[model samples]
Target: MSTSSSSFPSSASSPPSSSSSSPSSVWLVAYMKLKFFTRIRRFLRSKAPHKRNRAASDHHAAEKPRIIDAVVDDDEEEKKDTDKSMVLQKSVKRLHFGTWEEKEMAAEQIQRLARDDVSAKKLIAELGVIPVLVSMVAADESGRRRAAIKALLELANGTYTNKALIVDAGLYTKLPKNIEEIDESTRQEFAELISSLCSLANTQSCPSSYEIISFLISILESKKSSIETKEVSLGALYKLSIVLENAGALISNGVVQTLLMLSLEKQLSEKALAILGHLVVTLMGKKAMEENQMVPERLIEIFTWEEKSKCQELSVYILMILAHQSSTQRAKMARAGIVPVLVKVSLLGSPLAQKRATKLLQWFKDERQAKMGPHSGPQTGRISIGSPCNPREAEEGKKMMKNLVKQSLYKNLEMITQRAASPSSSNLKSFAISTSSKSLPY
Candidate 1:
């Protein structure tokens, strides 16, 4: 070793250089290169699975050729859903009572109520609601069409103009064809509508009344109807009879035989009686009598029937009217057997019925025997009193006479009491008793 203090400089211990691209530059470049390698490793690890899956998918997609088909199917399904929504909207339009453009979405509940044929027609005549609903009913299904027609009849009740339009629409002809084709509920509605039209015609002015009668007669003659339908048909005939009676043309319009037929129905017996009562009154009333003479003998058939409660009831009511009319009518009534029926019903019927019956008997008895000469036998060939009266019949007649007198006395006392209690009350007792005495046949 040299004695000098200067030692050879070790390469590891050399002083650091201050140059720009020295060790620091080399270290920075090495760090950047390391980071790049780490990033590359991570990307390779992540992309391996995705690359394999992509390869498999592309292979399968090529093999099947169904990708376009799948896409088309999805699009078609979406379109079908849209179309279904539109069809539902249209169905609603057909059934609803309002306008379609109102974009009115009706609930299922509302559809049923709005579909009633009768109610629909009735609503059509209302101020703004009619035109829209009528259009719906007319253009809709056959069931709805029928309902609308039925409704029109109800709407026509007080309206003359609507009635004319309904006829012009040919509703009557259109309705009956289906009357034979529809269900019971529909048939009932159909018949009722026809009846209403017939009734409305009667209420119309002049010439239309006769036209209504023709329609009703046609319905009666049709073989397609049931007994019930026939009964209603006959009822319409009787209604026409009333209008004719008012017109003083009851007999002129072939009403007598029609009325007689109506009287024979077990179901319509009461209606028949009412018609007869009206006819009797109409004929006896000063206006009707001034125009016509001779009661239609068709009215006398009621006297000869197998006497049921209803028939007897009618017999009493008619007798009451005839008994109160002039002596000539009373004589005619006696021959009709109205007198004996009155006595029988008085003794055997319900209290109110018996009272009415006995009262008529008493009233009819008041007339002298001479006045009853005309009523002694049947005036019409249609009526035949098959058997003769015996001693028992005469005795029964006498007993009924006694009961009538007693009832008359009791009614008088009641009348006097009522008059004292209420001065406004009529002297019903005195009138009833006196009339009874005057009409007595003895």
Candidate 2:
């Protein structure tokens, strides 16, 4: 009612102020309004139906409880493993049942499992299958006995722990007894088991070295034993010879003579030679071989045999050891004509054989030079002791050589006689006497 005829302007219609009247200002205002409206529209558009639904679902999920099934899956997996272990355990337990069919089936399963080291260890450790296997070794049924022996062999082949388990289960004692009456096939398996057990060093489950050696010797000496039986026995002896104590036992049990005889057989010579080589590492073994008298001769003969390249190499090595032991042993080797064979081997043998042969040749050369004096030249051929010498010194040298030969011969005779007179030599007296007579100096 008090208006003086003036009107207020609305925003849409306002115009013509000094700043707003310019074209640039009008455009700026229009742009600002358009930009603000555009931003509002974009904000409304960004809250889409699908995006809102996803957010609502995520919020609902977070608000709700999560029931984890991971533990359930892990438990299921563990249960499966437990079930498998239980099955294995049940199968192993069946081995001890009194029924023949059950025992045989259990043994067959064990044989299959024993081939795997993991399964073998499980059978022995987790399942305690060794005692059952030992009992099966004593079973009167041949098939069960063989199956048990085979299973044990597989188990023993795995680890030292498995071998000790077998031993603790009385396999060592029971195996020897089983070997007594079993057929050749079963005997071979028993022998193999013994060999495998003995291969483990310092195992209490192994048969005593003496018992093992005696058993092997008897097998080797048995004409009724199959070649495979004797071979495995020889292999066991070879393994046993690695122990120093066993070396003494092997010799004391007359293993050397058996080995020496076996060394001549075409099929067994390599193993026999390898065993002999090991045995001679000990002082007692060397003495035993030397006392046997035929050992060196056989070795020399093997070295010269045309088809025995491996045996020849071993023989050369063993002879080198024997020669290095003493001058007398070297002289004995020389008397056996080993020196010439060594020279031949040096010239024509394999590289390894040639190397060993050269060393031995040099050793004999040094030995000869020492014996013949420093000025002595190498001998080209045999010299006659009766040949006259022109110079006095030459004559003295010849006489000295003759005396050395006679002394060597006498020394050899003395050794033979002494060996013959010993009680142990009673069995070998005729052989020693004949050897001495043949070696006598005319």
Local error of candidate 1 at residue 193 (angstroms): 1.4
Can you write out model 2's per-residue Cα lDDT over 1-442, one digit (the tens) per residue? Answer: 0111112112343332334477888766555444533432343233222433344445545433331343345456555444443444445545532266776777777676666436435434445568888878877888988888888787777578878877777765564532355577877887898888887645444645555667778778877789888988888888877666667678889988998998888799999989887777677777888788795788888877666778887787677667663788878888878866765666566555665666666666656656755434324345588876468657667866786775676455444333323232112111111222222111
TM-score of predicted model 1?
0.43
lDDT of each: 0.47, 0.65
Q: Which stretches of candidate 2 lie over 4 Å from their true place?
A: 1-90, 177-180, 202-208, 374-442
lDDT of 1 by residue, 112-158 (tens): 33343344333333222233334433333556545454445456665
Clashing pairs in 2: none
lDDT of 2: 0.65
Evaluated with lDDT, which candidate comes out highest?
Answer: 2
